[model samples]
Target chain A: MPVSIIRPIDIWFAEQIFPHEQRFHAAALRISGSRDEAEELVQEAFARLFELEGWAAIEDPRAYVVRMLRHIAIERLRRRRIVDFRQFADTDHLTLADDAPDQHRIAAGRERLRRASDLIAKLPERCRTVFVRRRIQGESSQEIARDLGISQSTYEKRLARAVELLSRSWQGDEDALPAAAGPANTSRRSGSR
Target chain B: MSIFNEKQRRKRRIAREAATWLARHDSGTIDEERFHAWRGATPEHAIAFARALAVWREAQSKADADTYHLLQSRFTRRRAAAAIGGMGMAGLLTAGAFTSRAYAWDSSHSGVGECKRLILPDGSRAMLNTDSEMQWRFSDDERSLWIVRGEVGLELVRGIPARIHGLDRMASLSHGRFNVRLEGAAMDVTVLSGKASAAPVSAPVVMPGQPALIPIVIASPSEGLLLSAVAPSVRKASPQHLAATIAWQQGEIVFDNEPLQTAVREYNRYLAGKIVIADPDLTGIPVGGRFTSTDPADFLSALELGLGVRATPSNGGYVLTR
Candidate 1:
């Protein structure tokens, strides 16, 4: 519960490293040819970034992440004693990719924000109440718990449930929830009537 | 499968813990040292916490009052089912007074040289270009947008195709991305990835020696349709052309072998201080390059360097001459 003062590293990672996640995942997929391996490669690159001391001095974070992913993939292949040099041959252009936010990326960001709303709506009724009040409406926990005639712990639990489901859903987890909410998984997007 | 399930469970546990920490931080009841220790425990922990923070920050800023009201209105069980049914029945359930009014009709206007992005109630996204005005109305069975002026880029969600009304004509836009501009009674629609069929708002009165208004369907990303009562034409747009069309979204104007007058006029859309060609002869000269839309300094410099032209400050604008 780091309150009041945020770590400088967290800010750098969230701003510089996190925004380019889709690209990193895509690149990792191209190298690994498996979703699970791609996820692991991206996570390992992020972990290495956390341990880096010169992280702040990097001018282009997207390219830095791409290079890191390539290194991590190479390391994994070495450990497994099977390396596909061809897979990594044409990837030099990726490190030189433009870091500017393009029109498609801008649209994707808007879609992400909208998807957040849709995910919140799909939450269970109890969890949705706490989430809408605390997260979206910016109501204090105490105020929401009191207004809803619930105990403080109950409010926290409901909120935590909402957050867990939403986090999984946002990360594209198909089994994030059960049929109690509806189908276990909907498409990437479910239109609101 | 069991191993995968185990991994999933561990991931879920980390996510839940991170969320709890974030909540505690928000409520001002966190132990800072313990929070740092937990985050430093593993790479997955740090990643989980970062994801939670991203969601928290986005909801804190992007989910504005309108979205909040919409969420509250659809808070009930039956209404939630209706929303999921995707049958456009949620609006008919008397969702809420503020909810219906807020979602049924909304309008926004962007100032000159300023662009704005909006998330409509039906989850559709619209970006208003400089000096643009638009309004949206969503009912139980229909979704429509009215571009009163200027340009708008639309990304319609998958459900009901949206009806676009501009000037005296209209277009039916299905799920896709489109750039639509209203220029003096004409609607220019460039479909980036969608389907659009343009027609007049009313039945055309066929008269002697007058061509009847024909409907045009633009189905490919390489097509742009100009919809007007007088003359409606479909033009093939290359990939480069499409990129140039939406370059304004990135605060850029691209000129590919375009006349100097045409480029100047396009750039003028995003500038407060207009650029005037004092020499009429230079107007027809072809110019090609990309320049920032909001500034004319680089553009003028390019003109000066490319051709034997000079710019002089005149009446809060720039006058160019050979």
Candidate 2:
């Protein structure tokens, strides 16, 4: 049987780096304009950052990591330019494109986002952790449960509760514009495949 | 409560349902056709789902920005302290050591009857099959890893060369995905994406200054198998076989008219109880299916119905007879 040792670095990464994964992923998605490429870029950035001797010394790890991802994305885009323009054109289908929104829409979206954040912040401690780990960090339920010292079913329940609470908080809002930006539903599925 | 409150509660309930459906869809456990039907069941359901999705996306991006700002502020404070050059550097260095101690060799393993996917520190990925153990070590110059036991499917990042140590062979891969299964003293290396070269662990080290274009041996090495003496073994694997071999990554075992014994052995790797074919003749019977590795009930039922075999619970595991 293999030994199961929980290393301190694992704990540190779980605490510091893992929590910001959603932000890093979002930034990559904005820059790369493809979920697959974004995921890859983020992973690469993490790998590179983890290898750095002074990773813990970095002032803002999330910003540093996101910046590294942006650099990598730019480099990748440059290389792909030489190989094929068609592949670059396909990136326009990204749900989280980096295009500038109208001032009115930006202001409205920011208000909605702030409200959503407030709702998330009001969630029970365990529920909030579960939600952030599962939805934001992109961790598996099993992994989150193992880390939280809970059963997978319990983790799922907490996540469901968190989602329910957030949905309830945003339910009566009149500014929920219909999803008009991109093919949000099918994009993730196709990207994974 | 007021009628307005009641209406708000109803809207919340609908939003909750939509959130649940979205989660189910994302988890890959829901049927797409059924999900589409549910979405189209009523106008309210469709609108609620759209709103839920929008909220989800908005919250995700907002969380990212919030986290970024929070970290930025925290870092600014630390930077101020470091600029003063009083105990900050030492403290940060000590903390860094503690944080990065795990990066030396991130060892991971899959227990018996379990499969696992690992995202390594260096933008590489590894999927371990049942009862597998692997270690990842990345440095400034190179990314190195070793599969100590069982099997692993690896996807290496572009422009980075990796040196992999399997059971009895070492493989040098440059920007590709590959599956390596170690059985006894021999190993099978199948390149799923780019290029890889393998050599016996006992082979003399060949260090050519330039990029070595080795000849890869796809076949498992036998006692008298003559590999090209000078050229290192490198080859592009067939896509079909690569997919079939790596199907375990998706929690499946695909058998293409494989022997009953072989199929049973593969199943046994991912199951608690072994399936023993009592009759030697029955062992050679061909079986084919795409089976979920954890459950053997379907395979057993198919054997009973199609092959007319009887499976009985034995003290050790299960005994199959015809």
Candidate 3:
């Protein structure tokens, strides 16, 4: 809890562990089922790690931090006792829980979500279908291929195409234009004053 | 394929392979040793694998209810089959064309203190006032525009049969210039040139100055159409009111003996920090000016000097009291 006391060693430790931060957060999200909880759990774990004596001597720090965060998440989950496994099973994935603070991060996340949605909207119809089936509907590759009357390899290719387009969009490539440049900027640029 | 296309295809193939490996890894089906070996095979492989993993994780985590609805609406099973049965490449080309055209005609928005002018595909022009958003749809047979929020001035072609939809009513124009303003559920249509027939989407046109409930509909493909019923009264726009209504387009706020409350609201639309009237009695004080829309400080000075009101800074904005 003494995390407010900043020190050079803490800064060094945070920098050392920065690369693994996302992976640790992803693992924590898997266990916590909430992005805010996962972020808090990871920050708590980092603070705890910094408080430990001889922190410099720890090997495989990424694994150590991940393990600590997972333990914290599991303990919190047990304490809450409100974990309904049925909610996880439901594919609706409603993000009703408010995650306040870090407005910049929330804005960036929303922008990413908007961009991804726009890219998905522009996908070739067949490719989009395969992607939705595999990712959103949680359908298996073999089942989708059989249902679509396409070879398994072809289905996989379509899925890959969808992924490729999404990746390009996230990377802000020309093929998948950014949402800000979508209708407004394009028209402004092409139309005469 | 050209060399550039060939190179892109090769990169996509690698990315796809990496994506497949990451998917398997996430599902607990991949051989860890082989996966590690494949990732370490080359620096490019590791980079692709990392990017693919990030994309997959983000896709999984961010697919909330809104995204689910969008995907479901667009990628239904029957439509998927039809798209595949038709020429796949042609379907993709047409989809791309539609998307670009929609972009060109979809929406125009202006930030605070900023005015935007847009030239429609048919050579007509529209100027949007500050803090406004409008959606437009243009086709070979008809030209339709919806002022979803804020104010817009249109200079239509001679005979385009254009229709402008506002909050509580829709105006049909055959060849004229006009402006539409929507505040909350109230719509005010000003005819600058020629003429337009106004009617509620769900009801017949009512006499001017009579209160009537009118339903407004905004057409959207994914969500169908959004309909809102609002009680609004229409007015035959006079020259005096029309100029004041669109003064912001000329970078000024022309308040002609309006209430302080109305002038403050109009000023807030074009400025960043808002002006708050702390006393209820101050709302009825008459205000008239031709100040620049971007300068609220000048307005405050005028209020303090001419109206015998005191202006004090409060909560990141100025509060006025008499």
The local lDDT score (0 to 100) that residue B108 gets in candidate 3 is 81
Which candidate number would show the highest DockQ if scored against the true structure?
1
Provide DockQ values for all models, in the order shown.
Answer: 0.13, 0.08, 0.08
RMSD per candidate (Å) reads 23.4, 26.5, 25.6
Please give the C-alpha DockQ score of model 2: 0.08
- In model 2, what lDDT does residue B200 have? 45
Question: Which CAPRI category fits model 3?
Answer: incorrect
Docking class of 2: incorrect
In candidate 1, what are the lDDT values of residues B1-322, reduced to their tens digit? Answer: 6877797788889989988887777667678899889988898888877777766655643454245334332112222323334433422332232232235467999988999999988888999999999988887688888888999989898878788877555778889889998764457788877788765444464476977666445545556776654435566554335656777776777764456887788888887888899989988665555567787777787777667679898888899999
Q: How many residue pairs clash in each candidate?
A: 0, 6, 0
**Best model number under TM-score:** 1
Name model 3 segments beyond 4 Å from true: A1-193, B1-105, B203-234
Top candidate when judged by lDDT against the true structure? 1
lDDT by residue for model 2 (A1-193), tens: 0001212233334334544455566777777666656756866775665457775345445556656776776578786636455544544433234322222222333454566666677677888898787666657777888988997556656776666666544432322222223666444333112
What DockQ would you assign to candidate 1? Answer: 0.13
